[model samples]
Target: IQALPVSKTLQLDLLLGTTQRFVRTEPVRPLFKQLLEQVGAGLGEGQGLDAMAARLAAVEREQFQPFEDRHPFVWKNLLLNEFAYAMFPKGGAADIERELMGIVVKFALIKLYACGLMAHRGADFSLDDVVRVTYVLSRAITHNRRFLPNLLQTLQDHDALRLDVMTQFVL
Candidate 1:
């Protein structure tokens, strides 16, 4: 696959580019949303994060069809495993609300990553679509789950870089 010129300035261009291809061709949003819901539901009635982590560790990995004629990929499994560990790095239980927040933020990060990857392909999303997606994610976190201030700040900090790449793509 030919890399878009803007891809050079974007980190993880190849991985994100591959991910973007899958994102464009497949129903990835639903799968990601479902997985997030399933994991969130696993924290029912104040369940401990450790328990949910253990459950995720045992769950089978999901396979997604790659773009065009490429072979299927197991990215979901990697995300699940890595996020599970990252959520509770010290191997201890966190408050259920906090745990759910972590899950929400992680999913949001993945979505953001996908958006960045789309830019790598020179696929421009409308500002309205971007606002809608941001609203949806923020609402999801604020409504049923806890808010993550740190994650929000981190995302905000990347706004300049994101805009720079988009500007480069546009130019």
Candidate 2:
């Protein structure tokens, strides 16, 4: 597989930020820490991103399977709720919503990429795969919401929509 254009520094920062955010959240913190430790232990030798992603997926599945079995859409609900919060963050300037939404989109893209990579392992995956996965995930996440109308309303409501942030998320 060809290397993605994302910088190692940016990847490290995203990983650290994600880890810290999850670790700070109560109830899930212990489980998140345990998953991280499990991933660390699984990365014993010359394993690469694929191995790490697979291990993380395995650990997450093992940990969440029972809950998932009981509440099939729990993960999707959690993700959508997070995205909704980003769209309308409290106690911050309204202008920050774009940045927060961009961050959420970035994390969502990373997840989609990881899932695609795992599913298409040894297949002829390409940048088109990324685009397709992004589209599909976006559709799935936004299916229940009137996302486009709300986004348009937000654009009309806010003076600045932060095209730079949107562009950053796109590219």
Candidate 3:
């Protein structure tokens, strides 16, 4: 977040991704430390920007988990919720969990891009193919642009969100 010349915009964008779409997972201790470092470096001279970029990039890095890909209703709930809030994929929403939802949506996008499970496209899922739920399919179909970027940006601006999630992951 500190990487941008506009520290405030970076912070706001980070907030939007977190409060609205981010999922409540993982401890924020390490994430917060990273954010602090980036912001701190940003406070300095030229080195600050580079440090901030690295820090922001670090904040935005993707954390991989083997998505079992169940929870169709949760996925559907996400779609229904996202659309209700006008964040139809790329439409955008301003709800808590938006960040997390975006993450889930991206996972589905990667799956689709790789031509993984095609059931959403009339193919069947393997018993252990990390099945994406119907809701995810809906988001994938309805909000491709927004959903995908939200996912990528989470990795891209992870430090910002990490700053928030840190409170939840109290030591």
The segments of candidate 1 whose C-alpha lies over 4 angstroms from its true place after superposition are 1-75, 87-94, 122-149, 152-171
- Any residue pairs clashing in model 1, and if so which? none
| Candidate 3 lDDT by residue in tens digits, 1-171 | 333243422432343234224323322334333332333333332444344334333332321111224433433554455555544445345544555544444433323221312212223333333333333344443444453455456645665444343322211
Model 2, span 58-99: residue lDDT tens:
533543244345555644654566567556555478656655
For lDDT, candidate 1 versus 3, the one ahead is: 1
Candidate 3's C-alpha lDDT? Answer: 0.36
* lDDT for each candidate structure: 0.37, 0.42, 0.36
Q: What is the lDDT of candidate 1?
A: 0.37
Model 2 TM-score relative to the real fold: 0.32
The parts of candidate 2 lying over 4 Å away from their true place are 1-4, 17-28, 42-79, 85-171
Worst 10 residues of 1 by lDDT: 60-69
lDDT of 1 by residue, 1-171 (tens): 124343322322222223333445544346345433432453221345345333322221111111211322323443475456555444456545445445544453444433432232222433343344444444444443223444434334655224343333222
Of models 1 and 3, which has the larger TM-score?
A: 1
Ranking by lDDT: 2, 1, 3
Could you tell me the lDDT of residue 150 within candidate 2?
Answer: 41
The lDDT leader among the candidates is 2
